[model samples]
Target: MKIILKVLLYIVLGILALCISEMLFFFILIHSNNTEKGNKTVIMKTDSIAHSKALVVYQPSLMTDSTKNVAYDLAKGLNSKGYDVTIAYPGKYLSTDLSTYKVVVFGSPIYIGQTSSVLNDYIKSVNNLKDQKILLFVTGGADDSEQLNSLEKLFTNAEIPMKISFKYNDKGNENKAFNLGSEIGKE
Candidate 1:
């Protein structure tokens, strides 16, 4: 009986240790992102589109982040190339008039192996986008092929130029995102 109690106590302690470690990892990821990037507020400014300008739309995940987001990374990239950029969240910006911007970037993270609902709705709402450039970017862990393929199909059907889909890592890859944004601005 004593041996059984000892084993039970060991199991409980093991579970507690696992829980603590998981929580620690989560806290680290959140704070790491915050430190690397400043505030994460969505910028909705379109008043400066009279010059070279771009709009980036994305929806951040719960417990994930908005500041260290792939969308903001690309926006920063665009900024590096002298284009005025505004990054906005889909829930707030979907119905916005996008006629002034020269370039529009749709960015989102794959949720449950699919494109996020907010992003999908924003994409559907876009109309009369003739001659204006449209870009698609998605961030996700591991295989995003299914989400990528679906996005490509949507772009192909709409006759929009299909850019690259960025696979998201926990640690944001700002350089790659910046390169893509710079290239878009040059075009």
Candidate 2:
């Protein structure tokens, strides 16, 4: 009986440790993303003919931490390349006029083998984007690039015509995507 009680105590302690670690990771994510005070930025609206500006929206899974920063990295790089780029977080829950940007980038992390609610909301926000040059990006926690194909499908179903898309590691993989954004801006 005493041994059983000891085991129970050990189990309880183990659970507590796990919870603390998880919470630490969550706090870290919130802190990392707190790096900037976000602003609601707007670019010029594209005409019936596509414009030279671009909008990139990134939505990270609520459970994840690192995905929140990639969109900014991509945005800064594109800006360096002389692209009019705007980076917005989907959590702002704010909608922008999609007509303002020639290219709209919808990116998010894959949770439960699919895109998160943030991306879904962003997709829903776009209106009358027919023939618009859309781009898709995804960050996966455990799976492979297979997650990106589904993201592309989501854009296709939403009537977003994607010109290019790519997936990269959520941890420290930003330069390649930045380069990609620059190239996309040039197009």
Candidate 3:
């Protein structure tokens, strides 16, 4: 009986140790991901609508849900110049009508080396803009530029009036992209 109890105790300890290690690993991963996403989320509600009067739709969507980091400086730059801005992600609402917005900006994160399905659907749904203006802004890492540039060409060829910009892992790129947003608003 003593030997059997010892074996059972050893097995339980091993399992407990494994569980603890797994929990620690998962906790670390979740913590890091949250921190990264938190920094990006700072751009949300960044809509300074006083600059440009155009509706700005910034979407950061995975296959799961769509969210956005509002380009406040970009929106503000345009709004400051007197453009009205309305911002949203697909998750906020869906099947949105583009007819109401004269100038529309769609901001998307790079996914699988390309834009998300939500942005693609938005572009496809926009069949008759007549005189509507469209702009696409993309956020991605360094190697993503080639992919982003190519993606921008797709939007431009489709008459989206894209001012393609890429945000590398480096923070400065986002600022650069923000400046590009200003140009996009101007155009």
Candidate 4:
């Protein structure tokens, strides 16, 4: 009986240690700043002289490039559809002026069922979003309804025409993101 009790205690302790480590990792990931040089803003201008402008803002993940790739593909799609797309990371230097943009898209990677605080803060800092055409997308292991609902709540005053989720391992996510941008440009 004594040996069995000891084994059970050890198992419980092992699980507790794992949970603590996981929580620590998540905290660090959430607070860590990404200073990658490639994360600078990129503008994709359409060939046509008459083109509407669009902005794609996203918070890139430190662990993966999937979110960044999706943002670029989305911008490319908008560019192909006669929209001048500006792709930027959420930061202090990012322009908050949305007056010139016909449409705006925001994206972030969902980690442990939560989106990045940086992206959320940037969105909140912008004013007069009620009249803007906003679209949202999240990349994660699965489509989390709770996370999507939470993101939607941030834009309560605005009309979000589309909300999409792309899995990290999904092969066609870039194409899907691009297609979404194209669809938005058509409107």
Candidate 5:
């Protein structure tokens, strides 16, 4: 009976050690991911909006809602400049004809170093965009050079108004969005 008890105790100790090690590993991984975000050098440009009608079509991050994203700030900035901006999530059924807008802004969150598939599909579906002015922006935790290159290649005729990658919990990027809007509005 004593031998059985000793074995049971040893088993319990071993299980406890395994659990502790797993927990430590998970904690370390989480810490490292939070501490190390890759290079975040996102570059963008904006052209003046000659017409008042503007549409901001965007896809929110998987982890964040539309209100807490750079797209929302970009729309707010455009609105502040009196561009008659309409912000819509690309997943929704929109009654507005995208081609009618004088300046169309496309925003997306970079996932796995690329733009989400939904945004890509939405862009492809839009028609009559050859003459319309286009603006593009992306949000991500790190510099998404691959995503930018892919998007630039895809939207060969579109102008990249601004490219910004904001880290988690960053609130200071609104000014950049506002400035981009102002630059567009000025023209």
Candidate 6:
């Protein structure tokens, strides 16, 4: 009986150590610098000169390309609707002057049920978006309703007409994001 108790105690201690390590790792990741390595902006403009303008700002995830793919797909959809779309990464280089845009979209990847600080900081820095047609998107492993709610709360100052959560493994996520962008561009 004593030997069994010792084995159980060791197992519990091991689990506790693992949980602590995971938490530490998460903290480090969240606080680390997240500068995107590639091109900061991708423009998708229509042929017409009278096309409306749309902006998509997103923080790409290091673990997966899901967020970046969704942003590009969304831009493509907006471009199809005759809107000049500019897809950008959230950073110092991105211009916050959104006066010329008819529509603005912000996207982030959910990690441990929270959006990245880079996106949150960028959103806070931009001003005068109360009347803008703002759309939001988040990519994660699951569609957690609580996370969506929190994301909405983060953008409470803006008029978010549409907000969506895309699961990483979902096959139809790209199409869904594109459709959402197309719908928003029509407005």
lDDT-wise, the better of 1 and 4 is 4
Off by over 4 Å in 5: 1-51, 65-68, 156-162
Ten contiguous residues with the weakest lDDT in model 2: 42-51
Tens-digit lDDT track for model 1 on 88-174? 666543455678778888766665566666566656666656666888777766676677667656542345575556555544467
Q: Total clashing residue pairs per candidate? A: 1, 1, 13, 0, 1, 0
Clashing pairs in 2: 45-100
Best candidate (score: TM-score)? 4
Q: Order candidates by TM-score, high to low.
A: 4, 6, 1, 5, 2, 3
lDDT of 3 by residue, 1-187 (tens): 9999999999999999999998987565334322222112222222444432466655553322222433454565555445665655533233345666556676666654655555555555544555667666666544555655554554433465555554534456545645655666666
Candidate that beats the other on lDDT, 2 or 5, i.e. the better one: 5
Q: Give the lDDT ranking, best first.
A: 4, 6, 1, 5, 2, 3
Measured against the true structure, the TM-scores of the candidates, in listed sequence, are 0.66, 0.63, 0.55, 0.83, 0.64, 0.81
- Residue-wise lDDT of candidate 4 within 87-122, one digit each (tens)? 888866776667788889988888878887777777
Residue 1 in candidate 5, Cα distance off native in Å: 20
Estimate, for each residue in 32-150, the C-alpha lDDT of model 2 and write its tens digit: 43332245554433232433667887765455444555676667655665667767766444564678667678777654455555566556555666645776777665653566665
Clashes in model 1: which pairs? 140-168
Listed per candidate, the RMSD to the true structure in angstroms reads 6.4, 6.0, 8.4, 3.2, 9.5, 3.2
lDDT of 6 by residue, 40-100 (tens): 8889979867799999998888677888899998998889889999998887667777888
Give me the displacement of residue 124 in model 1, in angstroms.
0.7
